[model samples]
Target chain A: MLITFGAIAIFFAVIIVVLQLSGIKDRDFTDYAVGGRSFGARYQAMSFLNTWYPGAMFTAFGGMAASAGVISFYVLSYSLLTVVLMYLMAKPVWIWGKTFNLRTQPDLLALRFGSRHIRTIAAVVGIISGVPWLVLGMQALGTLFQHMSLGTLSFAEAVMLGVAVIALRQVWTVRMGMRGVVISDMAQGIVAYIIGSAVLIGLIVWMVLARGISFDALDQKMFAIPSVGSAEGPLYLFSLILTGAIGGWCWPYIFVRLFTADGVESLKKSAALAVPLSLIFGVALLIFGMLGSQVPGVSAHPNDVWFIVSKEAGGLWLLGLAGVIVLAASMGHTDGNIQATGAQIANDLVGNYWQLGERQLIVIAKLGMLALTILSSWLACLELPALFSLAVLAYQGIIQLAVPQFLGIFWKRGNKYGAIAGMVVGFVVAVVLELGYPGYLPWAYGLTSGAVALVVNLTIYVAMAYLIPQSQAERRRVEELFDLIEGKRSAAAVSKGVREPA
Target chain B: MSDDGKTNPNNHAAWIIGWFILDAVVALAPPIYWAFDRNRTAILGLPAVVTYFVAVAVFITASIVAAYLAEARSGKAG
Candidate 1:
């Protein structure tokens, strides 16, 4: 345990040094929000992966898969589809961000609708839907810390310890903003994904060969993929996938990635790269959990299967290594949440309304991160349910942004009224249905509450869009925006055609 | 190719439509399997469902790469 904790300390020290050396001169709020939109393919790809594959994927979701069986694999499909969505959106989002110097998701909404109220409402929704997941993510660290301490620390003590460590890490996040976050993400991603994935593969191979557990040798539930007619059937799976794919980028941390890539082309390449890596890690870790079901006591405490199996197979050293990897991944996600939500609070909700300058905004953003850290840590100290459960609710609420964000980007007919209305209706419906009827919608067996809310949300959005047409000025502005997009496309095309053939 | 040798707006729209069609079909297939399959088959020692997942993952990955390359090619062309 000592050696493992020491290694983690050193790893964090190295990351801090690298961030400090990056000399993140975030002169303006734009630089703080998006690293001046200067990251290349590798940095962008890894950063995206690190943020997307949160620690709970290993602990909570993996445990769920271990216990609940094949239905959990829906994440794999939705995740990849989300990447495809990213590829399609990359060009327009990048063009807009670059053109307007937009720093956050609400900034894009404001640009598209030309309304401060839309931006404010979007910012409010972003924070409300985003904070729970952020708190839940911080709470996941309690599990990691407890496992690493080998029962020496109680769960509460472990949670506090995890909170302290994260607070310490936030110092760098506060200092450097997005530049620090992106650079540190690269290092942490390699550790969590590359090194951690290698450990998972090793364990799976060990399970199959050494333990001689055939893939089909598992429980019958493990083999069956539930139908929509069944309990975990179509509606359930569909809801999971639908919410996941549509809402994937709606998370402020993920949506903000649209502004981080150096170019549309770079963004496209990053999507291409990120999908495979996400699949590799997600599928591999889930498999490890599935195989882990064979080990005694794992099916009972499925969340601990990773550590349990690791300790069984390779003893204390490997378990410690696995702990560190999970820690790195979890912290990577937590830091992103803090930085992004903090920036949103400072820039969109406050700065937009208060008319703050860049310097003041940066200060507020850093302070926002600090305040967020303390609040979420306090939340973590209170024992919450597994992060996955909270995350599902978060997904339900955040996906409401899809009607406003995704549609507003692609369809010019969508007005701020529709965007704001759709988001409120969708979010309220989701929360009500989720709280009232937990899994499936009332009367609609198998349909997830999230999916139900989305259907209502989209219907309202479309109805409102057609009912409330954009004003002549709004229509003209939208046309101008699309023209800018076309201009970029034409420029790229002309450059290609006119250049001498090599 | 269309009546015009150059890629027309219709063709571009068709490509996008085709991409979505493929995406939906691919994404929906696994769930359909989950809805119906009784786990009778195994591919390379893993359950058929898992095999289907690997296959779709590969297909989607190839499609993404191809799409990017095509975009890159289009950028290079007029």
Candidate 2:
């Protein structure tokens, strides 16, 4: 059952790729890159589904539930808070991006603080945190479709193959930019949701009509290991839940979406729908975890639950559906990470190096994204590190940025001296804590660096704010930046603003 | 300068921070003490099991407030 489904899934994936390559007309690097940054609310809604229903949610997170206890649910709880996180994040990031006329993550940081130091710090952190998750995804992809009796691809081979496929997908990405990725992400997202719902409904029917097991029984089986179902720690569980909502609050890729929105209203519209969309669609993966518990014979790895169920129910058809969902998850995350990384590199490094034109830099940006895709995919194939911990490590790294930048924006005294020193120190501290602690490294086992970094960061900020002499020009630069963000701009101000090429 | 224009979600973000410290004390002290010191005072001799529920409640409460404040701030349009 698993083998047949996998074959069918491969065929469907090939077809989807061929159609995307041939059928899409406006397939330029830019369009392919950020979906030309013209995504409407409806398409945006679809993109939300693709973004939320990721492999970790479907595949690995279940495994966490199996091993880690009820806290497995905590991974998901963070998702609910996204409603508030997105709303808080969207407009400010949107206004900043539109005003700066930015395209990438590094660009956002560099432009905001007007500091190469900030950009460099951001890029290094992006790569460190991002590389591991890509590897973890590759690991899951390797493990996916294990129903193949031939075992033509061992786990290593599968990881390699998956990474290769991701790299190939980016060929299209390299030429397209956010335009291509977001469009496909939206398409994949909507299709995954619709098809995922159908597939799940189909499975539920089989369980009810064919197997004679009730939903209540299945729920019992899932909850039978109550301790396994719940997460550990008092505050850590809450922290995990909160992290779901706000941890990714300032994620660079998500911020990019804000820039592309039609206006603040689109931002509002997207935010309104993003939460429930994530919670519902993401929960679809949980059904696989639930089913995995019921089938007593299946002793395969816990992550294999989704694949096994897909094969068991409808064989090839369900396998194809599940495959597509995983692909969409990997692609959506990869695209965002790559684009944000590319944007940072292009704006901070490449543009600075060559002082290139918009046409040239945008082209370079696409290539840079391609580079990042390959690098991340290769890392994914290695899969030595654990997933969620790595994600926490990365989250901690990015959230580190939130401290300095947040202070710089909101507080009058948040000067460059404090911003730079605080960011640097916070980053070093995070790295040391991550490295020194064993479980803490790739996953957040010991303590959340968000608190430490924020605390250490604020302490330095307050001290430096008192010590550093406030410069008039620097003050003007920041005030003017905020004013432009608040839309108090003249025609001259608008023209002189956002150095996006003549 | 007067704090009227744009507020940081840090107001509630701070509360999340507070809960994190409480969790560290409740959840980690035993293991931390076990690893470093054989001293019972390090765990503070507190029951580990109940801490999980207490911490979970605190985290959930803090998250709700954070989410509420973040959304409310966004609605204000900077």
Candidate 3:
């Protein structure tokens, strides 16, 4: 069964590789990496879903839900709510991307702040911020492979399998950049959704008729998974949800994606579709969790839920399909995010101080992705409590941008000094709280840091906008950026399901 | 805050509708729970909490109703 599954998976993988590589148009690195910053709704939606929602979260979330009960929905909802936040921020980000021709976050900071110092801080922070996520993704990938192997492979062998595939996949990523990444993502999204939906419907029907189960029965069974042993209050839901949605828009990888869309409306339309797609995919995991609740037949870990479901319910060929789809999902995620962070480091930090060529920039970006992929693969071996924890930790720090960036974009008085201060302060506070207290209970609520970031960012922005005076050039740049965004929007366009950032 | 925090000052009603939807999503927890509990299997004397469970039911009548109202309110007075 395992051999048959692996064969089917390899076959589907080859097809995906051909589809992704067939039309690679990345003549240069920026085009390869950022796709020259022009993504319509379809591409945006495809890439966003594929790239945004991967890692151990997908593999482990179902198990966590099985353990945590109703609270599990919070994790899933937190993931989905980010799209709504993305919808709000996409307008400013796209407008800025178009105006400044910015490809990386550091580029945006440098363009506006005109300070290499600020860009360096932001770039380094981007790399540092992204490390845990990369490692977590690698870990989840390794875990999934091992658990799926069912003792056929050793632990080290499992990790190596994940690493080998990632190493192979980077060959294309190093060449094509975001264009290749998106094409690959679109492929993954299409294939995964089809397979995922088919599996879900099949499971739903099988469980109802064959297994004789319902959602309520499933919920009741799964509810006792996360035992709250006097930790945070149930209100933790409120904080986590608030932080997840609000802080979510600020994530560097996902944030960079907003800038890659074709236009404001395209971005928004993609967002409208993207949110529900994320939710549906999420529901598939939840259902799988419900199936696993109190039932034990396989020796798989949290990350192997998809594989387990496929292997148990269907034939060997379907198991192979599940493996390839999961791997594709992982690759699509790492490609854009790793490369984007690399570009940020090279351009924002190195080039900000000294001019770097497209060739040099591309080389550094490739190296960066290579290093990040390897590092993440290695990190996958460690005992990280759960995928959900790492995901939240990642957002807990970055979400501080809820005030400084997401809200700051529209606010006129939003000055660089205030935003910088708020972000710095909020970033520090969040990390400390998360480290010192850490959130497992309902009370700590994910939003404590989010709220702090919002408050500080707003307070600082308002005060700075009022007290500080921008030089003529800076004010003009701000006005130009805003004006371009305002003049371009049309009411009729929105009615046609064209989502605008505004 | 200019009655609606119109930072960019292009439209009014859309902003309200957006923020309203956002706030409602955050504030309304009990109703969400109620719908899940009732339709999936009504327990005891309590009616469904959400008053509208789009997730349950065969035809998705609840989702349509909710979506229609949201659309109507968000629409401009042409």
Candidate 4:
């Protein structure tokens, strides 16, 4: 118990010290929201990893692999596709963000559609979908604390401890803003992913060689994946992969990472860099979970497989390290979500209504962060069994933003009415279907509610694009935005002697 | 388009679309994954299905790196 608690305490102390030395003071709202758009490839990559894989990667996701078999590989598939999307979208997103001083995903939407109403609607959807994940992050911390206590603390006591620690971390998050969140993500991400991968590899080696555990010895059911003929139906895995790949960037927190990069090249490099890291870490972690399922006590409590296996393999010290890794991951995820949500609330929701200065916006954003932390912590303490289900539903709802986001950036004909209509209608359909059908839709041939809604959403968006024409001024503005991107690329090519001036 | 001075805004669209289609086929296609879905074989001490997915991940990573290099070579990485 002492070893585990001490390790976590030392980890927190080092992170706080690193953050303080990194200079958390922001010169203005841009610096506060995006670190003045000055980060390089590595920081952007780590920040994405930190936000993308929450501490639940160890608990819930690992648990899924332990209990559910090869279906969990969907995460790996979608993660690779997500990075591909990042690389593809980096140019327009970064260029527009820098040009318009856009600070949130909704801010980009507003800029693309030229409507405050679109901004408000997107912001509301982003916040509503975002809050559940924040709660889940807090609950993940609760699990980490419970295991770290080593029977010294009850679950309820651990819940409070977890909530309190995360709440305390928000003090710095509120003060230093996105810059602080990104820097700490660097430190925390190294601990959680780099060192965490080493630990996973070590555990796998020990389990395989020492314990003589191999695929042949385990239950054959563990190897089965959902297929065309299976009860899960053909499209189950496809739907999951599609949603994760597209919906990933729709998250305000993850989308905002694009703006933190210094240039499109930095984001491109970050996308490339993230692919291998995600593959290695994700594969190793899930492999460990699968192998650890055979360990005593793991089958009954699969969510604790990470902690149980670490303790069995390497004793107290390894368990301590495991706890620290999960804590690091959870802290980074929670901090980023809080910062991004706060920025959206301040810059998109509130600032859209009233004329506010940069200083006032920063103040409002900090207050928003505080409110979100308190709300998520309180929800975490409730220990609701339905919270995880709500988080899954949030994924369904969040994906509704994808159509508008993709079309708005890639195609200029998508008017504000179409964007708003598609998002509102798609979000409603997702929520209704998710609540009615739960995980998968039988009538839709195993497609998820989100995927079904997306089809309808895209149809409406495309139809509206043709049905409603933009005003001449709106058309010119949209044309100029596209021209800005092309003009910049052509100038860069000419300067590099790759092409002649037009 | 670049040679013609039109400067196609989505010069990399072919790369993105091509890889995306390939990935979907590799990951979700019934013909490919179904071949290894069974646990009759263990490669590298892992179930064949698991090993196949890991290989798929590696393939995707390598593809992204290839695309990045190609973009850089074309001077469109910015």
Candidate 5:
């Protein structure tokens, strides 16, 4: 217990020291919001993977794989597809961001559509969707706290410890802002994915060689995909992948990273680099969960498989390392979430209404982060529904941004009214269906409520775009913006002074 | 086509369309696992479905890297 707790304490201390010593000087809202659009391939890639793959990837997704067999491979599909989406979206978004000095995702919407109302709507909707996940993330840390405690602390005490760690992590986040978040994400991502991969690999080797449980002995169905005729069915998986691929980048934290890259080409390189790392980390966790299913006590509570396996393999010390891995990942994501959500509130929502100076905006953003931490911590203490379920519900709302954000880039006919209306109607449909049907919608016969809502949302977006025409000025402005994006994308690489790889 | 009607390899439309095709292939291909997911088949000591997923991952990675390189090349040329 001492070894575990001591290691965690050291880990926390190291992160703080590194963050303080990094020399992140935020001169204005630009630097505070996006690191001045200067991150290279490594920082952007690692920071993105860090924020994208939260600790829940290990706990919830891993647990799902262990309990549900091959059905869990949906994550693998969605993850890879999301990267492809990233590669496609990154270049255009980067150009626009540079051209307009855009910071938040809502800022992009407002710029693209030429409407502050769209920005306000995007901000409000983004915060509403994001708050639930923030609350859920704090609760997830409760699980990490319990595991690290090794039965020494009561559940309530563990929850408190979890909240305290998150609040403590926010200190650097508040000071450093986006620059701090991305740099720390790179550092913490290394600890979480690279070190975590090594530990899982060791655990797997032990499971196979020492325990004598071969893949052949595992459940036959574990290797099989669920059919459309099965209880869970094809649409369930399809909806998840659709939501994941499209909505994955729509998350305010993830989308804003597009602006942080140094150049358009750097964005592409980041996507290429992020793929294998995300794949290795994702597959390793899935394999860990699958192998853990063979262990005795772990199969019963799949969520605790990583901890149980660690303890069995190398005692409390290993379990302590495992707990640190999960904490690193969870904090990496939670901090980015707080920073992005807070930035959106201050820069887009509040700044639009009131003209605040750079220092005032920074102060407001810090206060927002502080307020969010307290609220999320308070909610984490309360009895709430499952963390994973709440997260998926948030994704349903986030994905609604796809049509207006993604398609609006390619198609200039979309107006602010359509963008705002699509998001509002999509969110309402997702909420109504989620509340009425919970997870899967019987009304759609095995299709996820999210998928059904998305269909309605897209239909509304397309219809509104055609029916509600953009004004002549708005149309002309959009065309000029699109031409600029295209021009920048194809312009000579000499401007960046970096030769393209042959 | 350009105003001269010559084929343009560096055309943004071609790249975008090609990317979309690749995206559709990857995003829609996973459902094919349903047809060959049975555990009776094993490949290189791993389940056949697992092997299939590995193949798809490799394919997606190669395609994206190729696209990225091509874009980089085109951007540099202009």
Candidate 6:
């Protein structure tokens, strides 16, 4: 127990000390919000990974594999597709972000549609959906702490301690802003994904060869996937993969990764580099979970499979390392959410309403981070069942942003009316269907509520584009934005070149 | 290729769109995955379904690398 706690403590201490030494002071709001838009492929890749897969990857996702079966591999498929989307969107998003000094995802929408109302709507939706996950992230730490204590601490005591540790980590988040978050993501990602993958692979080898826990010995049902004749229907796996691929970037913390890269090329490089890491780590963890189900106590408490197997295999030392990995991943997740949400609050919500100075915006953003940290920590302590359900539904709701975000970038025809209407209706429908059918709609043939709502959302967006045509001026403005993407010479530049020849 | 003797951006875009289509079919298409859903075979001590998806991921990664290289050759990466 002491060794496990000591390992976790050392992990936290190293992260904080490194953050302190690397912290930059006197950064303006832009510098604070997006790390001054200066990071290479490796930093950007790690930051994206840390934000993409929370600590729940170990607990909730691992549990799903242990309990359900191979369906958890949906993460691996969607993650790769998500990276492809990131690569495709890199040029347009990075160019616009750098060109117009866009800081948040909402800022990009507002710039594209020329509407502050759209910005506020996007920002509000982002914050509302993001808060639940932040609370759940804090709760994930509770599980980590409980396991690390080796039965010394009660679940309630562990919950409080986990929340407290995460809340305290917000000090650096609020102080150093995105810079601190990115730097810490590098360290945390290494522990969580790199070392964590190694541990998972090692344990798998030990379990299969030494302990005789091969697939042949396990139940055949663990390998089955839902297919055409299955009860869940054929589209079930398809919907899961599609939702994850499209909705992956809709999370504000994940979308903001676009702004952190140095340029479009760097962002593309990062997307390429992120693929293998996500595949290896995600696959190894799920495989471990699936194999660990054969262990004595794991099937009963599936969520504890990662820790249970670690403790069973190598006893205390490996368990300590596992604890440290989850702790690092969770801390990175919590910090990223806090920083991104804070910047959205200050930049999108408040800054749009009032013209605040840079320093004032920075202060407001920091204050927002502090307030959110406290609120989420308090909510995490409640451990409400309804909140976890909402966090799951939040994924469905967040994907509503995709239509507006992608269309606004690619298709100039999508006006603010369409963007706003589609998102509002899509989010409401997702929530309603999710509440009615918690996970999937049986009536919809295994299609998720999110997918059904997305269909409606896309219909409305396309219809409105033709129904309510943009004014000539707005059309030209949008044309100019697209022109920037194509590298077309502007009228002014063309005239200047001709005149210079004389 | 365009008349300027450079790779046409539209062709590059087409290739990318094609790659994405391939990826979607391989990763999400029910029929494609259903073919491998049987548990009769195991490649690396993993079920056929699991190995199929793992291979799909690698294929997708290679496609992305191809796209990156194409973009670099066309000088459109930046």
Return the top candidate by TM-score.
Answer: 6
**Top DockQ hit:** 4
Residue A162 Cα positional deviation in candidate 2, in Å, after optimal superposition: 1.8
lDDT comparison, 3 vs 6, better candidate = 6
Report how far off residue A256 is in candidate 4 (Å): 0.1
**All candidates: CA RMSD in angstroms?**
5.7, 8.1, 6.8, 4.6, 5.4, 4.4
Off by over 4 Å in 1: A384-391, A488-502, B1-17, B29-31, B76-78
Question: Which of 4 and 5 is the better model by DockQ?
Answer: 4
Please list the C-alpha lDDT of all candidates, in the order they appear. 0.78, 0.56, 0.59, 0.85, 0.78, 0.85
Highest lDDT among the candidates is held by which one?
A: 6
lDDT of 5 at A364: 88
lDDT of 4 by residue, A1-502 (tens): 8899999999999999998998777899999998889898899999999989999999988998888877788898888888888887888888777766788898888878878788888889889888888987887787899899887888888888999999999999999999999999999999999999999999999999898876666677777766667776667777888898899999999999998999887888888888889998999988888888888899999999999999999999999999999999999999999999999889988998899999999999999999999898898889588887888888898899999999988888988778888888998899899999998887776799999999988988998889999878777767767766775333323222111111
Pairs clashing in candidate 6? none
Q: Rank the candidates by TM-score, best first.
A: 6, 4, 1, 5, 3, 2
Expressed as tens digits, the lDDT of each residue in A374-397 for candidate 5 is 888888888776665676677777
Better of 2 and 3 by lDDT: 3
Q: Which of the two, 1 or 5, has more DockQ? A: 5
Q: Against the true two-chain complex, what DockQ does each candidate achieve?
A: 0.25, 0.05, 0.12, 0.36, 0.26, 0.35
lDDT of 3 by residue, B1-78 (tens): 001111233343554445536443643243343234324334342113211221322112222223334433654111
| Model 6 interface CAPRI class | acceptable
What does the lDDT come to for candidate 1? 0.78
Candidate 3 regions with alpha-carbon error over 4 angstroms: A1-5, A8-16, A19-25, A112-114, A216-231, A298-303, A381-392, A440-454, A467-473, A488-502, B1-78
Residue A376, candidate 6: C-alpha displacement in angstroms: 0.4
lDDT of 4 at A166: 91
Q: Which stretches of candidate 4 lie over 4 Å from their true place?
A: A488-502, B1-10, B13-17, B43-45
Candidate 3, A8-105: lDDT as tens digits: 35644774566565776555656655787666778888888777767555566666655554455555555655665565565566666665567777
Task: Please write out the lDDT profile of model 1 over residues A197-245, one tens digit for every residue.
Answer: 8888999999988898666667777766656456654556666776788
Residue pairs clashing in model 4 are none
